[model samples]
Target: MTIHEIDKLTGQFYECICFKPEHYPKYDQLQELFYGDGKLINGNYDQPLEFTVQSYIQAIMHQIDDGNATFYSQQEISDVTEVFGKTAQRISVYEYSFTAENTAPWKRGVNYIQFILVSGEWKIVSMLWNDEKEELAIPEAYLV
Candidate 1:
């Protein structure tokens, strides 16, 4: 997929499962666009800007436990948005889940999402799923 596609797709994904706390930063950026101050954004997006060595791994553990997720490819680094300004290409492997009768379990083997940088941050713009025959477009109204 093209860089532009990845950006749009990631934006859509953020819009989708946004009720999940970990995804809050994506909307935080959007709020920054609407509000003159970053206070509202900062207050709402509560992930800390830094972490200690052990806390860093702990954070990851906490995230996975809470269903914090990301899409990446085995062949490339997922564009988590580099702190420095630079563009890089990566392969894709998308993973998300569907709610079951009483709970939701992570669904694997969806697609490889391609991402790109816009305004100095990386955003998913496109998805290349292995199951091309059953691809789904996340609805805008579905986002909270």
Candidate 2:
């Protein structure tokens, strides 16, 4: 597939799954777009727990519910690169702005998502992300 089509699909990735929490029920469908069980690695573990799709979904929902958070997200797909012919990746600098009824705003982050061309369609294979912190900011190249 052309990189342009893949780019649009990447936008859909952010729109369908990341930005809209109401669509969380259909998250498994999103997961289905991935190759394996897949993972969303948020750097909270000492040994990098590979979160299966189900685990990630459950954790995300639980966090929102337990924290009483109203979650919102928007991503700017800053760059896309083809790893190999059928393997591609994109780095998105996103505004994951959310707020809890009793807490401060949620931190923004950058995500690196890899997609594999399975059958005829592109599917996400792995996703890794990290929140921008005071000590460690997003790199300049990732910016628009």
Candidate 3:
């Protein structure tokens, strides 16, 4: 019903994935932010990788288990949200790094997230994101 709720949920989305070297990610918290049929997609590569909420958590756990991501941090830099009745969408710009000590983010990306009001609470329906690359830099407008 309010943008503040949306903002808070988005903030939680970022928080649930971040972790320090001595701590594990709070991925379990994600289950509470999404609808039962929610989906997440990573479009960084040629072929988009899609996952259900549970699968997304498993994938991240696997990354940690493989030691590919011991410490990771991701935060939204900017976002634009639009609401219409019970549906809303947010295009968020984010920066992230695999190491917690990095002075600058190693990568930047955009996430297009869709939300719907279910039983008076907003829930994420789907989220799709792509990382910035050499030929595909983030637009200056989004950086602000």
lDDT values, one for every candidate: 0.35, 0.68, 0.89
lDDT per residue for candidate 2 within 1-144, as digits (tens), equals: 468767777676676555334544346466666688876787644666668787877876776677554455555636746657888887877765553233535466787888888887887788888778888798888876
Return the TM-score for candidate 1, rounded to 2 decimals: 0.28
Give the candidate order by descending TM-score: 3, 2, 1
lDDT against true structure, model 1? 0.35
lDDT of 3 by residue, 1-144 (tens): 469999999999999989987988897788999988589999987799999989988888898889887988889989989999999999999989876675754688999999999999999999999989989988887766
Residues 52-144, model 1: lDDT tens digits: 223433554466567654421112213332222334333333333332233333333323333445665555433343321235433333222
Model 2: ten consecutive residues of lowest lDDT: 97-106
Write down the RMSD of candidate 3 (Cα, Å).
1.4
- Using TM-score, give the best candidate's number: 3
List runs of model 2 lying over 4 Å from the truth: 18-28, 44-49, 64-67, 100-107
RMSD of each: 14.0, 3.7, 1.4
Candidate 1: how many backbone clashes? Answer: 11
